[model samples]
Target: MIACLWARAASRKQRAGRESNREQLTAAGNGSAGPMSKKTLARPARGARGGTRRRHLTVLFTCVGRRVELIQAFRGSAERLDIDLTVVGADKSELAPALHLCDRRAVTPTVLDPGYVSALVEVVRSEGADLLIPLIDHELPVLSQARQRFEESGCLALISDPGVVSTCRDKIATYRHLKKHGIDTPRTWLLEAFAKRKSRSFPCFMKPRRGSASFGNYVIHDDEELHTLGRRVPEPIVQELVAGFEHTLDVYTGLDGIPRCVVPRRRLEVRWGEVSKGQVAKDPRLMEIGRRVAQSLPGCRGVITIQCIMSARGRIRVIEINPRFGGGAPLSILAGADLPGWIMRERLGEKPRIRMDGYTDGIRMLRFDQSVFLDRRGELL
Candidate 1:
C-alpha cells in the first residue's frame, strides 16, 4: 500500500510539473508574475458550459516559533491573491491560539508526532495543499522527500533533491561541498577519531556537524578547554574561528536560479538560540557572498540564508548555510522584501520584481515575550 501511494504521488507530481511549465510560459507571455486577475479572466457563472473553474490553491507553511510568524504577516497577500495558507507544526493547538491575531482563515494542522517525514506527506496530501513550504530547518528533510514523492499530486513542494538537501544539512558537509565546488569557505576538520593524550593547539570550536541554534557549541580558548569539551562531545570538529563583524545574509532566489534580493544585517544580539537584534549593513561583500552561494546551489529552491564573518583582512568567510526560511525573515518582510510571497508567485510561474536590500538601513530587534510566574506565599511575616 505504501509503495502504491508513493507511485501514485510521483505520477501526479510529474503531471503538475508539466502544468507548471505551461503556466510559466503563459505568465511570461503576459509579462506577469502569476495568474491573471479574476476580473480580467472572468469565468461564466456556475453551471455555465463554457466557463472555466477557478482552481483553489493551498499553500502549506511548515515550521515552529518565529518563522511561523511569517504566516500571519503574509496572510493578507495570500487571501487577496486567492490562496489559502495552512500552518503545520508539532503543536497545532498550542499555535492555533496564537494565529488568531492573523487572518482567521488560516489553519494549523494536527501533527501528532514530529520529524516523521512519511506522516507529514500524508497530512499534506489530505489537506489538498498545492504548495509545501518548509519554514524551519529541521523540516527540510521531510519537505524534500515530499517533493520527490508527490510532485504531481496537485501540490508543489519547494525543495531540492534529497542528495542536495543532505549535503546542505550538515555544516561539515556544506564546507566540503562548497570547497569541492571551488567556492571559498572556512577551514574545517572533522574529528572522527582522536587518540587520548594527543595534545593539540587551542582556540577551536567543538560542536556537532549537524546542529543549529548554537546547540552543543563551545569556543575552546585553550588546551584545557578543548580537552574538557572533547570529553563532553566525542568526534567533534575543530575549525579556525573567523572573527570581525558577523553578518546574516538573506538570499531570496527566484525560479530562474538567480538571487532576486540579498539583504545583509549585522547580528547585534543573540538570545537563546536565535538572533534577537540586528541591523542592515551596507556591505558589498554580503551580496557578493550571497550570489556566489546561490550560484553554487542552483538546485536549491526557495529561501536560503548564509551566516558569514567579515575578517579584519576584509575577507568574508561563510559560517553556515540555512536551506529554508529563517527565523529573522520578518525583518526582511518589514523592509519590503517578501521572500515567501515571491517564492509562491515564482512556483506558480509568475516573475516578481524583487527590491534588493529593501529593509531600513538601521537596527531592528526581534524579541519574543516569555511569561514568568511566581508562586503565591504568605510567609513574609
Candidate 2:
C-alpha cells in the first residue's frame, strides 16, 4: 500500500476565510477491526479481601484503518492499570496501517456488505473480545441491532441503543431531535424543501444528510452554488450558515447510562475531517450541554462525540452528534480522563473514579504526519 499524507495546516491568516470552524472538524474516523491474543475473559477478581488483582481485557476495533493514536491510547491505559490487554483490529483492507498495528487482525466484509455484521460478530466470538468499539458510522446501526448476539457470547458491544443510533445517523432527524429537546442547533432542511422556497439564503451549508468525515460538504455562497453543489451531493441537506468557534465535546458515559466526563476541545486546525490541532478549553457551558444530551438521549451508553459552535455572545449552537469515540479522543484521554480504561474496568465489575471536570485545560494536541513503510511482502519495515 502507498503512504497516506495529511496536509500541513496553512498559516492562521491564510485560513481565516478558507474554512468554517463550525463544520470543518467533524470527529468521524475510519472503522477498526478486531485482533486476538489477549482477552480479559479471566475469572472475576476478588473483593477487598480479594485485594487488587490484575485483569485482562481483549479489545476489538472495527474498520480499523488509520487510528493508530487511539489504539496506542488504549494500550497505554491498560499498562497504567495493570490489565493484560490484547488489541485486535478488523478491516476489509490489509493495507490499513492501524490494522497491521493490532495484536492480531482479521480481514472482513465491508460495512455495506450484508455479511459485515455476522463477520464482525464471529471475530468477537473467536477473539474472545471483551469490548467491541465500532469506529465507523455506517456500521453503528447494524452493530446496535446485533449487540445482543455479542452479549450472549460474553462480549460487550460499545454501542448505543437502536433508536439513539438512528437519531444520530440521520442529519434531518438530528436537527428535529435537538430542536424538540430545546437544544440550539442550526436551522436545517432537506434540499428539496429548502430549494422550493422563493426566499433563499446565501452562504448556507450543504452536505449529504447521511454523510460523515466532511465528505461532499459545501459552503454555498448563492442560489446557483447551492443548487449546483446540492445536486452534486447525494441526499443533501441545506443548513443556515453559522458562525462561531468550533469545539468538539468528547462525552464519556457509564454503564448506568449516565455521563461521567465531558471534555471540550477547540479545533485549531483540521486535516480532512478529523482534528489536527486542538486545545482543551474545559468550558463549563459545553460540559452542561453534553450533560443535557446524555439526559435527552435515552439508552445511550459509552462514548459520544459532539460538534458545536459558540458565538461571541456565549450562545452555543449544536451541529452534530457521533455515538462513538471521536478521531481526536486521544487528546482528551491524554488529559487524564482514561475513557477506555473506565469502560473496560466497568465491564470487569470494577468501579471507575471519574470527575466531570478533571481533565487538564489548555493542553493542546499539535498533530504532524508520519508514514509507515511496508515491504513488497506487506510486512512492516
Tens digits of per-residue lDDT, candidate 2, 29-131, equal 2124234324233443221124565577778898888887777777777767877777778888878877656667677878888877777777776667778
Using TM-score as the measure, the top candidate is 2
| Winning candidate number (lDDT) | 2
Per-residue alpha-carbon lDDT of candidate 1 for residues 1-381, written as tens digits (9 for 90 to 100): 122332333234324443443121111122233332221112211112223433244555554433434654455344445444443332244333222222111223433345345444444455445566666666676667667554544456766667667877787888888887776676777754332336544566677777777777888887677767867764577666767777888888764557778888778887765788877775777887888888788776777788888888888888888877677766666565667667655655556677766656664755666321223541111
Task: TM-score each candidate.
Answer: 0.72, 0.87
Q: How accurate is candidate 2 locally (lDDT)?
A: 0.79
lDDT of 1 at 272: 67
